[model samples]
Target chain A: MQKEENKIQAVIQINDLKKSFGTNEVLRNFNLQLNEGENIVVLGKSGSGKSVLIKCIIGLIKPDSGSIKVFGEEVTDLSHDNLDKMRVKVGFLFQSNALYDSMTVRENLEFPLRRHWVQKGKENVNDLIIEALKNVGLAETIDMMPSELSGGMRKRIALARTLILKPKIILYDEPTSGLDPITGKEISRLMLDIQKKYNTSSIIISHDMNCVKITANRIILLIDGTCYASGTYDELKKSSDSKIKQFFD
Target chain B: MKSTILKDFLSETGDLTRFTMSFFREAFRPRYEFSEFLKQCYVIGNKTLPLVGITGFIMGLVITIQSHPSLKAFGAESWLPSVVSVSLVREIIPVITALICAGKIGSSIGAELGSMKVTEQIDAMEVSGTNPFKYLVVTRVFAATLILPILVVLSDAISLYGAYLGINLKQVVSFDLFTNQIFEKLTFSDVLPSIIKSYFFGFCIGIIGCFKGFYTINGTQGVGRSANSAVVTATFVVFIIDLMAAQIADIFQIT
Candidate 1:
C-alpha cells in the first residue's frame, strides 16, 4: 500500500527474486519491500519458502536471479568480507534457537561481540551481556548451559544473543514455534517490546495465526513461490478469496 | 547399480578433496584460532593418552612373549630386546596407536560436529559473522595432526618398558642391559619414518572426521551415520597411509 508513498525509505528491497532447487522452484518472481521500523510477517505454510526468502536477504542462500538491496547495496555482488560486515547489522534467529551447547548463556551472548571485535563504549563485555540478559528477563541464566534451560527459556536466551549486537534488522524464522500457546503469546509480546525498544525493522517467517496477528504491521501471504496477497490482518480476514480464506480457516 | 555406486564414490572423493583444499586455504590465513586450537589439543591429547598407553603396554608384552620361544629355539634368545625394539619402533606401535586414535578421536569429532550441524549451531555461527570452519574444523584438524605424533612417541617409550617387563618374566636381563640393547638397534631411520607416518595418519583422521560431520544432513540419523563412517573410513585410511609410508621408507633405504 505504501508503494505509492515516495517519502518513506525502504530498508530492504527485493525485485523479481527467483531461486530453485534442481527442478523444484522454491521462489519465483517474489518481490517485497521492508520499510524502516516496520514488522512484516511473511505468512506461509511449511515448505512455502518463507525461510528461503529471508536467507536470500542475508546471503545464506544465493538466488538464481534477482536484486536484493539492503541499504542500497546489492547483496549478491558483495565480497565475503563485506558480506560479513553487512551481517553485523542483520540478525537472524533460527527456528531451532541455535544456542551453542558447549557455551554458557553469557558466553553465547558474548560470541558475536568478540567475533566481530566490537568495541564497547565505557561498558565492558560483562556489562553488555548483563544488559542483553536483563532485556530478555533472563539475567539469572547467565551461568547456565543451554541444556539447563527449558524450550521457552532457550528461545529467550537466543533472542538475547541476537539483541546483543543491537542489529538494525532482525529476521525471525518461526520465532514462536514448538511452544505452548501461553509461552507463544508471551514470546510474541516480547518481540513487540524488542521492536519498540530497539526500533528494529523485522521480517518474521511464521504460520501461527496468533503470532501473525500480534506482530505484523503488514502481512504477506506466500503461495506458489510468489506473494499471493498482502494486507493488514483484519483486511485479509475480511477477504473472500479462497486462497487467502484457507489461511484464516 | 554399478554406475550409481561408482558415481557416488567419485562425488564423495571430489567433495573431500575440495574440503581439504579449503582447510589449507583457511589455515594459512590470519585471524587464527589459537585458544580453540589449544583447547582441542588438550581434548585430543590429554584425554586419549591413557588409552594409547594401555594399548602400547599390552602390545609390547604380547609381542615379546610370542617371539621369545622362536628366538630361544634358534639359540638367539639374547636378541629378544633388539628384535622387539626394532619391530615396535619401525612399525607395530605407530600403526596401532593411529588405529586407536582413529576409532576414539575420529568418531568423537564426527559426532560432535554432526550434532552441531544438525542443530543448526554451525549455521548460527555463520550468521553471527564468525567463520565456523576456522573456529571448528581447522583448529580440530591441526590439534589432531600435532598431538598424534607426541602420542606415538610416548607409546614407543611405554611399549619398550613393557617389553622389559615381558623379558624379566622368564629371564634375568637387567634393566640397564635391556635399555642398551634397545638403543643399539634403534636408529634414526627406524624412529623417524614411523613418526612421520603417524603425522599423515593424524591428518587423514582429522580431515575425514571433519568432512563427514560438516556436511551432515537428514537430522539425528545422519549424525549417527557420520560418526560410524568416520571411524570406518579413518581406520581404512590409516592402513593405506601406513602401507604407502612403508613403501616410501623402503625406496629411500631408510630402514
Candidate 2:
C-alpha cells in the first residue's frame, strides 16, 4: 500500500517510451518515475540517449509510442497551447545554457515571467529577478551580458532563469559537462540547495559521478537504449553486475 | 541521385508553404506583438535607407547617361527624361532595392536566427511559454511587407532626381521642366504595379530568411549555409516575382 501511494505521488511518470530517428533507435521501451521533491540523476555515456530522454519528457521530441504523464496528465495528448502551459510548470536547463545573447542577465531572468503572462508590478519583477540571482550567487551579474560571464556564471544565470518561474519540475541536461571540478561541485551543491528551498522534483542528466553523488537522491543508469539499472548512489556502486561495476570503478 | 535532389526540393517547397500558412494564421490572433513589429520596421525600414538611396541614385544617373547618346542619335533628346523616369519607376529601382535588401537584410536575419537555433535559444523561448514564431517571424515579415513599398517610392524619387542631374550635364534643362517631364510620363499604371510587386519581394525575403534560419541544423556550419542560401534564394525569388509581376501587368494592359 505504501509503494502504491508513492507511485500515485509521482510528479513525472514515463512508461514503455520508444523513440527513434530513422534506423538509429535512441530510446526503446524506456521507463522511469520521478516523485515529488526528489532529484533523480540519469547517468549515461555521451551517446547513451540521456539528452533524448530529457527532450522526450519536455515534448520537444515526440515518442514513437508509450505514454508520459506529468501530474496525472498525458503529455502527448495536450494541444499546442496546453503543451505551452505545461512547459511553464516544467523548467528545462539546456547544456549550452541558451541564454538570449542580446539581453542582459536581468532581462534573461525576466523572460519567463513576461512569457507566461505573470503579472507583477515593476518593483515585484525587479524583486523576483534579484531573488533568483541571489539564490544562484549572481546578484552582482544582473546588468552583465551572458557573453561577459564565465562558463560557471552562465550556468548559474541559466539556472536562475529556470528557477524564476518556480517550476514544479526541472530537467537539466549535462549540467556539469564542461566545468572544472570545483565549479562542477559548486553547481551540484547549488542544485541541492534549490531542491531543498523549493521542494522541486528534478531529473538531471549527467556522466559526472561526483555530480551524481551530490545531487542524486536516486540514480537511473541509461545504457543501450534502456534503463539498465537504478538505485541509490551507494546501492548501484555495490552492484556485482559488470556493466554496473564499470561506472563505480 | 537526381530523384533525391528532386525530393529534397519538393520537401523544402512544402515546408515553406506550410511556414507561410502558419504565419498568416497566427498573425491575426490576439496579443499581437506591436512593439516588436515597430522595432522591426525601424530596423528594416530605417537601416536600409542609405544603401537603397545610393544605389537608386547611381542607377538613375547611369541609365540616363548610357541611353542619352542612343536617343540623341534618333533626334529624341527630349525623350530622355520620360524614358528614364518610366523605366526607373516601373522596374529598375524596385528590383535593385529588393536585391540589395536580399543581400543585406535576408542574410542578417538568417545568420541571427540560425545562431539562435544552434544555441537552442528558439527552443528556450518555446519552452518558456512564449510563441517564438509569432514573436520572431510575424513581426519581421509584416515589417518587410509594409516597409518595402515606401522604400521603393523613396528610391524612385531619388533616382528621378539623379536623372534630372544627368540631363543637366548634357544640356541645360530647368529643374521644373525635368520634373514636369517625369510626372507627365509616369502614370498610375507604371507606379501601382511596381509598388505592389515590391511588397511581395519584401515578403519573400523575410519569409525565406526566417524559414532557412529557423530550421538550421549541423551547428555553426549550418548557420553559414543558412545565411548564404537565404540571400541566394531571396535574390532568385525577387527575379521570379518581378517576371510574374511584369506578365500580370502586361496581361492587364497596365504596362
Candidate 3:
C-alpha cells in the first residue's frame, strides 16, 4: 500500500538502470525519482553519464537491465506506438536546441500537434502558437527560420515548441549551456516561471552551477555511473565531502 | 585483414536488409504521410526535369554523330535513326539518368538526413510522436521509384527529338521519315525492360542514401562521409542492377 502511494506521487521512477556502449560502461545501477510538480536538477561533470540518464528516461537509449516507470507504466516494455503516446505527455529540449532548420518557428511549433493528431480548430492552433511564443517572449519571430535566429532566440523558440504541446513533464538537456551570463540567467528565470504557470514537473541535466543554483529545487550529483548524492542546493553546498565540495567551490 | 573486411561487408549487408524490411513494415502502417510524400515527389521529380532533359538531348545528339561515321563507311547511313533510337530507349538514357540522379538526388538526401541525425532533429521528431522513417525515408523511396520511370519516358521523347535534329544536321531527312524509321524498329520488348530496370535503380538510390544518413555518427564530418558514400554506393548498385537486368532481358529475349 505504501509502495503504491509512492508510485502514485512520483511522475517518473527509475531503478537500477544500466547501460554500456562497447565495453565502456556509461551507466550502472543508476536510480532517480521525480515527484509531481517538482524541479530536479541532475548535476554531473563532463562524461559523467548525465546525458545517458536523460536519454534512457526518454526511451532514446535502451538500458541493459533496469526498470523505468513513467506514470506507473514501464517504459522499457512499451511498444513503439505506446512509447510515442507516452512522449506526448513528456517534452524534451535538446542541448543544441534541435530546432528543425528547414522549418520556420511557426511550423516548428505546429509539428508536434500535427504528429500527434491533436484536434484543434485552425484558429485554436494559431492562438496556441501565439500564446507559446508570447510565453517565450519572442512572439514577433514567428515566420523566421532557426538559422536566422541568434543562439538565445533559438533556445527560446525551441522552448516554445516544447510548450506548444503543453506537456505535463519537461526534460531539459543543458537548458542554459552555450549562452552568455545574462541570457543564461534570463532562461533560468523563464524556466522557473514556466514551471509555476504550468505546474509541470521537470528534470534538468546540467553542470552550470548558476543554472543549478537558480532553478534546482533539489540537486542530484551523478558520479561513477550512479547517484552519488542528492540534496537541496544549499544543503549540498554546505557539505564537507570533497566530491560535493568540488562542485560548490 | 581480408577476412575482417569480408565480415564487416556481410554485417553491413545484413543491416541494410533489415532496414529495408523495417521500411516496408512502417510504409504499410496507419497514418500515411501523403502530404509529405507529395511534397517529396514535387521536389524529386518535378525539379529534376531540366537536368534530365538536357542530358538526354546531348546524349542523343552525340550518339548520332559518333555512330554516323561508322554507318557511312558501310554505306548504311540510312539506318542512323533506327540504331540511335534503339540504343537510347533500351539502355543509354535509363543508365545515364540513374547515374545522374544517384549523384544529385542521392547525395542531397544523404546530407540532409545526416545533418538532421547529427543535430538530434530526428530524435526530436521521434519524441514528438512523428515517424521520421515514414516522413523521411518511405516518402523519398516511393517518390524515386515512381518518378524515375516518368523521367525516363520524358528523356526518351526528348532524345528522339534530338536525334531528328542530329540527322538533319548531316543531310536532309524529314522529321516524319525519321520518326517512322524509329517506330518501325521499336518494339514493346525494348521499352518495357528499360523502364523496369529504372525502378530498381531508383529503389537502390533511395534506400542506400537513407541507410547511410539515418545511421550517421561522429557529428559534422560524418555528414560529409554519408553524402559521399551514398553517391558512390548508389552508383555501384545502379551498375549491378543494370548488369543483372541485361542478363534477364537477354534470357527472356526481350532485347
Candidate 4:
C-alpha cells in the first residue's frame, strides 16, 4: 500500500444527474461521490448507463439536469475555454486506446506536452515524454505508430498519454475491456500501480467482477439508470439482492 | 436485396443528418481545441499530399490532351497550358482533392469514431472532463476549412506542371512563355471565382465527412455506411456548388 501524502479531498461530487436521448432515459437521478486518492469502480453492463454517467461527469455530454463538481468547481456548465482548461486536471484512458494514428508513440506521448508545455515553455518535453512512456512500460515502443502496437500495448500507450498532464482525477472507461485475461489482469494491476504512483482519485468504469475486486476501494453498481448500490467489495459479495447476486454469478 | 439496400441507405443517411445538426450546434457552443486543430491540419493536409498531387497531375494532363484537338479545330493550341492551368486551378484540383479526402480522411474518421463508439473511447473522452464533439468535430472542420485552400494552391501548381509536360510531348513551349500566357489572359474573375468555389468544396467535404463519422450508428457497418454516404454526398454537393458559382460568375462575364 502506498503511504497517504498530501491527502487531497473529495475530487468529484455528483447530484441528481439526468440525461435522455429521444424517448430513452439513459440516466435518471444519477448521483455519485469520489474522494481524492480513492479508487472507485463503477460496475454495469453495456448500455446500462455506466458510460453515460461518466460522460456526464467529464462534461462530454451535458445533462438535462443535476450538477457535477471537481475539486469544488462545477464542471458540468463551464464555458468552452474554461472547460478545456479544466480538462487539464482530469485524465481519461479510453477503452479503445484512442491513439492518434498519425503519430509515433513518442510523438503520441509528447503531443499534449508539445502543445501546452513545449509551446508555452514548460521546461523540456522529451524527458517528460520519456518518463511517461517509462511509467506505462512502453519505453521501447517510442518510435512506433499506434498501428504498430498490440491491443494491450496500445492501451498502455493511451494510459501514458493520459498521465502526461499529471491530472488530479483519472477516469477509466472499460480499461480492461476486450483484452485477454492475462492482459486484462495486467491492465488492472497497472491501474492500481498508476493510482498509487499518481495518488489521484480514480473512477473506473467496468463490468468485470475480477477487475472491480482488484482495483476498487468502493464499488458503485448502476442498474438501469440509477446507482443501485455503493459499498466495498466485501459488502457487495455478501449482499442478498438478486441483481447484485446475479452480478457475482 | 433492393429493399435491404434501400433501408440501409435511408437509415444511414438519416443518422448522418442527425449527426451533422449536432455538430453545428456544438460548434457554436464553446471551447476550440487548438492543439487538436493543428494535428488535424497535419493529418488532413500533410499526409494527403502525394495522393492529391498525383490525381491532380493526371487530371491536368487529361484535360490538356482531350481539349487540345477541339481548340486545334479552331487553331487555338497555344491556349493549351493556359486553359489547363485555369481549369485545374479553378476547378479540377479542389474538387478531386476533396473527393480524395472524402475517401481517406472521411473513412478514417468514420472508422475511427465508429470504433470508438463501439469500443467506448468516445465515452471515455467525455468522462475525462473532455468534450468529444469539440475535440473531434471542431478540430476536423477547422482543418478542412483552413488546409484545403493551401492544398489547392499546391495541387494546382503541380497539375499545371503535368499539363505543361503533356503539352511539350507534341509541341515546344518554354515554362516562362506558358506561365506568361497563362497569366496574360487569366483575369481576376476567372481566378477568384474558381478558387472561391473550391474552398466551399473543401468545407462541404469536411463538414459532411465529420458529420457522418461523428453520428455513425450501429457497429462496424455503421462506420462503413457513414464513409460511403459522406463521399457520395460530398461529391454531389461539389458539382452543385460549382454550377452555382459558375452561373454567378457568368453574370459578371467571368469564366
Q: What tens digits encode model 2's per-residue C-alpha lDDT throughout A19-43?
A: 8989988898999999999999998
Model 1 chain A: which ten-residue window has the lowest total lDDT? A114-123
Cα error, residue A18 of model 2, in Å, equals 1.0
lDDT of 2 by residue, B43-96 (tens): 988889999999999999999999999999999999999999999999999999
Off by over 4 Å in 2: A116-118
Query: Per-residue lDDT tens digits of candidate 3, residues B1-255?
Result: 999999998998999899999889988998798998899899998778899999999999999988999999999999999999999999999999999889888998899999999999999998889989998999999988888888999999999898888888999999889989998999899999999999999888989999999999999999999999999999999999999999999898886
lDDT of 4 by residue, B53-96 (tens): 89988987888888889989999888877777777777678778
True contacts kept of each: 0.69, 0.75, 0.86, 0.36
- lDDT for position B145 in model 3: 85
Candidate 3 yields a Cα-based lDDT of: 0.92
Chain B TM, every candidate: 0.99, 0.98, 0.98, 0.87
**Candidate 2 vs. true structure, TM-score:** 0.97
The DockQ-derived docking category for candidate 4 is acceptable
TM-score of predicted chain B, candidate 1: 0.99
| Whole-model lDDT per candidate | 0.93, 0.93, 0.92, 0.80
Ranking of models by lDDT: 1, 2, 3, 4
lDDT of 4: 0.80
- What ranking emerges by DockQ with the best candidate at the front? 3, 1, 2, 4
